[model samples]
Target: MKNNSAMTKIPKGYTTITPWIISRNTARLIDFMKKTFDGEEIARLYNEDGSVGHAEIRIGDAVVMMFDAKKEWPDTPAFLRLYVEDGDAAFRRALQEGATTMTEMTDMFFG
Candidate 1:
C-alpha cells in the first residue's frame, strides 16, 4: 500500500485519537476543567466574531479539544471518564467547585 498523502496524517505531539467537546460555553467548560482536574489550556483558535473556533486543554497526559457550538451544528453531549490519583479528594473538589453529584463515591473493583 502507498501513503495517503505527502504530509503526515496525525499532527506531531498529538495522539491517534482525541476527544473533541462541543459546548455552548467553551470558556466556562475550560474553567471547570481547570478547577475540577487541574487542566491547563494548551491552544485556542478563535473566530472573527470572538467565539472559540477550537481549543485544547491538557489534564495530566490526556488532551481534550473543545469548540463553541453554533445554532447550525447539532448538539452532541460527551461524557468523559477521568482517572485521578485520589478519588475521594477529586470528588470532594468537584463538589466544592459546583459539580452536582450524580452518584456517591464508593470503592469498586473497576476503580
Candidate 2:
C-alpha cells in the first residue's frame, strides 16, 4: 500500500490562508464582499441584540468568514489588501460603498 500522505500532487481547487476577519460592521462587510467580488452569503449568526455574531461569504473562489469583535477580542479586525483585476475600479467601488480612503489608489513600482 502507498502512503497517500507523502504524495506531492497539489490538491485541485484548494486555497491557502483564508482569513477570518473580525469587525463591528460584519453585515456591511458582507454587502461589500458581495458587491465587490460577487460573493454569496453562506452562513450567518446573529445575537439577540441584532448584531452579527458570525458570517461567511464566498467571494471569487475564496471563502471569507467574519464575526463581530467583542470587547474581549480587542485585537480582532479585518485588514486586507486585495489584488484585483482592476485596482481603479475596485477602489472606486469601495469608496462608493462608504470606505474612507486611507490612501488614494495609485500605481507603484512594486505593485
Specify the highest-TM-score model's number: 1
Question: What TM-score should be assigned to candidate 2?
Answer: 0.73
Cα displacement (Å) at residue 15, model 1 = 1.6
- Cα deviation in Å at residue 40, candidate 2? 2.0
The digit string of per-residue lDDT tens for model 1 on 12-95 reads 767767899999878888988898899999988999988999999999888999999997888887888899998788888888
| lDDT per residue (tens digit) for residues 1-111 in model 2 | 887663455334325556798886798889988887667898899998888888988776777778877766667545776667887888788778888877777888989
lDDT of 1 at 81: 86
The positional error of residue 34 in candidate 1, measured at the CA in angstroms, is: 1.2
TM-score of each: 0.81, 0.73
Model 2, C-alpha of 52: deviation from truth (Å) = 1.9
Every candidate's lDDT: 0.87, 0.77
RMSD for each of the candidates: 2.8, 4.3
